[model samples]
Target: MIRTSLPLKKSLKPKRCRSCGANFNPISSMSKACSVPCAMALNDAAKAKSAARAAKDERKSLAERKAKLKTRREWIAEAQAAVNKVARLRDLLAGHGCISCGARPQQKFGGTFDAGHYRSVGSAPHMRYYLPAIRGQCVRCNRDLGGSAVNFRKGLVERIGINRVEEIESMQWTAKWSVEYLERLKKVMNKKARRLEKRIEAKSEVNQLEAVE
Candidate 1:
């Protein structure tokens, strides 16, 4: 006996072009477009849109770069001014002996000195960066005193005796009180004092505000 296989049945269906509304018999049922040109045109449109978006992003990046450069230049100028101000103050305090040790310039023995302030910058803005408040100190003395007014004073008393320190503090000066000298001294001291006072007041105000918040 001979046996034969039955033929597969076909489903009723028609293929259509998505872009041109044309109909054709596609090898597969899932195919949408009738010709390759329709697919290429769709791809080209998508590529053009992507290129436009990239160009827009590049322009935004360049604008951001320019803004950053402008900000950097402004900061550099402010830094230079601060450095110059410090230099001027340093020169003005050179003639004074070590603020801590009272060691005369001649007694320094070629040792370098630092201009120290009685008040630190964080706690006392008035004295922190002022020239008159600065004092020359030998490296060893500065280290021994631990760079604090209280510590330095204690060390000074130990080194020179309390009587001598009292005498040094009591020395009187008689000078022709000139307007120019008074103005110069006030210029140096007053601004710093005012700023320090303002900062303290502001800090207190902020604390109150924070408490309310």
Candidate 2:
């Protein structure tokens, strides 16, 4: 049931202009702009949005093309570099010095340390990204003397315990790393590295505050 309770309006209510928020009596139901200037503004805004979307698509296409040009080995190396970066930062945060020569990493990642592996990637590619199998080592021991294997063993046993070190030593799987797997690994490690950086920055701020106090 319907009841006529109050007085009626003289005409339909004014519509809000899409471009300018001003209210107007639209010329037609389909009209969105209140005036020619507002119409022009709306058109320009739509065109700019379309252009920006097109630019984003073009950039994404270019990145895909560049990624496609890289070889499987290149992908592997890139993923490995990301893993090493995260591993080095991990050891640095833990206050563990070089696993080989017992030299300390400079308080930062500053090219003085390398993420050395207990089993070289050439020998055990399966453990390439394994955290327990890798440690931060001074550049001198990792690059100059080739991991300093004998010393690294003693250090590895102490850090991860003998059972874990032996488990790594006795592992016997043939790892076939795919480009897809490496790509995923790279993205994950990069994310972790960023988080680690934030943690380090927060710790530094705390230390500074303590010193001031």
Over 124-209, each residue of candidate 1 has an lDDT whose tens digit, in order, gives 53333344334455565656656757655665465457886566445444334334443445455555545555665676688799
Query: How many clashing pairs in candidate 2?
Result: 0
* Count of backbone clashes, every candidate in sequence: 1, 0
For all candidates in order, the CA lDDT equals 0.55, 0.88
**lDDT of residue 2 for candidate 2:** 90
Which portions of model 2 miss their true places by more than 4 Å? 1-53, 107-110
RMSDs, each prediction?
Answer: 21.9, 5.4
Those runs of model 1 whose alpha carbons end farther than 4 Å from true positions after fitting are: 1-95, 104-111, 151-213
What TM-score does prediction 2 earn?
Answer: 0.75
Quote model 1's TM-score.
0.27
